[model samples]
Target: MATTNVALQPKRGRPSLARASAIDRVILERARDMFFADGFDAVAMEQVAAAVGISKGTLYARHASKEALFTAVTLDMIAQHSTEAARFDHLLTDDIEQRLRHHARMMVNSLVQPDVRSFQRALSTVQHRFPDLAASISEVGYRYMVRIMRDDIIAAAARDDIPVRDAEGVALMIVSAIGGYQLYETSTGKLTHEELQAHAERTIDIAMAARSSW
Candidate 1:
């Protein structure tokens, strides 16, 4: 019997899969830009489809609704932030305090960027309408920062670098301090690079002093 050469057959779905993924990315990038440029309520699904050069049916097939698309864009932003954070890992020093100061400075720098500020303002406008999604986003972003600080505290405690009875509590306080500073900066003018460094150092010092007494 003659055998069919299965290995020579062309793949059926690979090209479509690749094309679909590329289209999805384009949709997200365009949608994010539109949403940021004009707040969420102003950006329609049809607009996103037109921006991506796709049919409204195609956009709806992928995202179902504008709310769902915005959620995806927000999640993508968080994922990008996490990836950017990972890139600074090699720059961390052995000392926990210095490591934390570096992290604080990094957060301040990232948070104050024009693009980040625009996205944040856009999210803030719709937060009341989408409270559940807002809560979820806050939890994910806040917990990620707390977890990083908690791990550092635990490691430093193990090495007797710092005395702390509650690593999680200390981490929360540290993160909260950074957040408070960020809020102040948003209300006031943007901090200079030197001012940002000083704030980070001061926040870390206060946390260290509190931990030492524990």
Candidate 2:
């Protein structure tokens, strides 16, 4: 048998895997920026490819179409937002009221993020054409927030921080309040830091006042 030079053969290694991941991340981040800046219907894949200095073939190899690209971008945003939310470990403190206020403030803070506001602004524009996509985006956002709120509320109740009546229902209400504020602020216009903070504080304040009576 002919000698096989296996020792000299080039092997696929971790470098290629790292390079692939880096490329994917660059594509997603650049595409996400374009998608957020311009509505999904408005952005072209070719434009994203150009922006990222990649050929259409390379872009297509990563994402089939604009809609597919949008899905990837949206999923990445969701995951990132969850990661950001998870880092707020201070909210699990013994001070129940402070925790609730901090959560609301954090929600408000996210609402003002360039990515979050941009994504919400595109909802009305893209929803008619891609109803399912729009709905999925909204549903995923709501469910994530609700789950976080529910957990926090339960924790607060367990610590006797807040009255433990209907924790799930209260959590949903809190999420609705925050979500509603976010929607309004994004669609209407920019809310100054002062204004955003005031709204967040007031929202939690009112909700807490109600819980006191319940």
Candidate 3:
């Protein structure tokens, strides 16, 4: 019997951990867009796989199902927000109003974002089906926003810029006012960037003035 020469090939199965994570990042990016546009009840796993340019099997290897993918996408957003807040957490300047304006602008950016608006719509539509997930995101996102604002409030008051006694309450007022104003502006007619900035500045002024009584 003659031994035949055999070609050796790299075994193809699942990706390595790092590769899988990279692939999952892409999948979640696609999933976020799809879920934002179509909502949880409307988006299908197959659609996400195709959109992500991956096979259903490959996608499933990363996420067990659409719900799992959605959860991952939500978590990804949460992580990104946390990272951004941390990135600028130490930016305490002499201008408390200016800092508040900056925070207001960040809130405005989030509230006025088309993708965020779509995501909010999607969440509201499907929250009934995923009550726990809805509650989780709502609580987490709200607290994250509040925490960001509260930290800034405390910093500014410590610097004697705002003289806010109730840092936590003042932060809530400032954040909510900016967010609510943006939401209103977006729903009515979109405000120009300049107009929104002006509005935010005015709101920050009012919030700081209200702190005088505190």
Candidate 4:
């Protein structure tokens, strides 16, 4: 019989590590909410930790600095969006108009989230101060938006309902249309949220209709 020397078993702390990471994520999300509402310059790391019912030392252990935390928060926001978008992607139907409508509704839902709206405003305020933060936001948020839209268009083409000539280009055009509508609301005047949703649906419908020549 081979002498199985089960020498001093190393401590297995994987569960503890996982639990700690989960706590850190919760802290980061709470901190992100406070920072967005109060502005990054006004918020402190201690305050963030306190908001999450954690100690500043614990927060620091997870995130080396305020800047790092801020960056992580932005990345988290993008991750949340991607998760939401994936849900919509799975709900895609054979009806092109219905799919467009669903997408429009989901977009409105995302924009109307209090935290998301605050995050966008906060980003606009400090993007100039931290270039890396701004770049990360751009790559995660903006770039992800473009890629998701493009992929959705491709899927629509495969479904054979939406006659898209060039799925990628058409996706960009759809994005541009939706973006223009959003800009009008943000800049010009107070458009009812319902009106914005309706406008987005119609705009998307018209754009998809243009691909009749598929």
Candidate 5:
């Protein structure tokens, strides 16, 4: 009888767990780029698999569907933005007004980034399909800013640096005002660096003025 050649046989089922996890990351990254570059409806699973140099079967094994992959991508993006926002803590100062100004400018600068805008556009494009995701995203983003502002306000009040009756309400108001300004900028036109700086300062000034009434 001829000797069997085991090595020549086809190699596999799924990859090793470690390898599979790595491939999953690559797939998500490539899928994210595609989704950002070409809108959700325009990107197909086949396109993503091709971009990752994987077979459609393999891609589907990792992510059951295109919507599932997009969900993963959205969560990844949110985690990344959260990490970046966390770094802003180091930029804060002992001066409450200056701290608020820094936060305003940093937040606006982050929103103006091309990749961030692309992600926002992606979300808006698919809002109807992912209403709950959209709501969660909005809540998380809004809550983070409000938390930071509220903490700063409470700290300042503790030190008698400012007079505020309701820290939480004040925080909400400030965040909303800045959010409105951001919306205006997005709808009208991009602001220059100087203009953004001025905008940040003006927002801080209004907040400072209103603290007495808060």
Candidate 6:
């Protein structure tokens, strides 16, 4: 009779996740700076923690590993770019060429960010060791760019502004052109900000001409 009085155990609920906030974002931004300045391989977890006035354990609690931190940075960069791209949607002009030019300008501006430049350089160095990092970066960076370009192409087609036999192919080519331009610039040397802007504008004009002609 006494054994029959045993109570049932309560079911466990899922653990709550920590959401990114202004304070957390500040910490992550500082971490990204350290990672960029020192390269991912050189920066240590303790360094990141010390930079943010936190302990190693605290940093680990926030981010599981250096790779995770890099992933967060990639995602953050993508989100920032997405927001910038969204603004163009509101101010989109009737001219398809104008839209293409705006997009090109955005792409050039994005690559010039000191942190972005560092991340890309670091990626090239450690891609062999951390293949996943490269893949993740590509997925979040290059792949995302391609998708956005594709959407823009589709939108232009919807408006009858650009004639495309294969919208996806055209979009891929557009992204490739931009990527090629960035790679070339990075390889040669750093161009002055104004020079880079001019180059992007010129490139966009040429690509758009080809697109329209096709």
Write one digit per residue (lDDT tens) for candidate 2, span 84-108. 8768865467665777777777677
Please rank every candidate by lDDT, starting with the best: 1, 5, 2, 3, 4, 6
The residue ranges of model 3 lying beyond 4 angstroms of the native Cα positions read 1-11, 53-57, 81-91, 155-165
Best candidate per lDDT, number?
1
In the order shown, what is each candidate's alpha-carbon RMSD? 8.4, 8.1, 7.7, 9.5, 7.2, 10.6
Clash pairs of candidate 2?
none
Q: What shift in Å separates residue 191 of candidate 6 from its native position after superposition? A: 1.4
Candidate 3's residue-wise lDDT over 79-198, tens digit each?
776566557646756676777777776666555555666776777777788887787887677666777677767776778754656777877776677667666776766666677677
Q: Can you give the TM-score per candidate against the true fold?
A: 0.83, 0.78, 0.76, 0.74, 0.78, 0.77
C-alpha displacement of 111 in model 4, angstroms?
Answer: 1.1
lDDT of each: 0.77, 0.73, 0.70, 0.70, 0.75, 0.69
Pairwise TM-score winner, candidates 2 and 6: 2
Instruction: Give me the candidate number with maximum TM-score.
Output: 1
Q: Give the higher-lDDT candidate: 2 or 3.
A: 2
Estimate candidate 6's RMSD in Å: 10.6
For candidate 1, write residues 39-144 as lDDT tens digits.
9999989878877776798789989888889988988887888787778889887788887887777776666566676787799899999987798778767777
- Candidate 5 per-residue C-alpha lDDT over 82-126 given as tens digits, one digit per residue, 9 for 90 to 100: 777677777777887887776777677666667766787787889
Superpose all Cα atoms of candidate 2 onto the true structure and report the RMSD in Å to 1 decimal: 8.1
Candidate 5 Cα outliers beyond 4 Å, as residue runs: 1-18, 61-64, 161-163
C-alpha lDDT (0 to 100) for residue 107 of candidate 3:
65
Which pairs of residues collide in model 4?
none
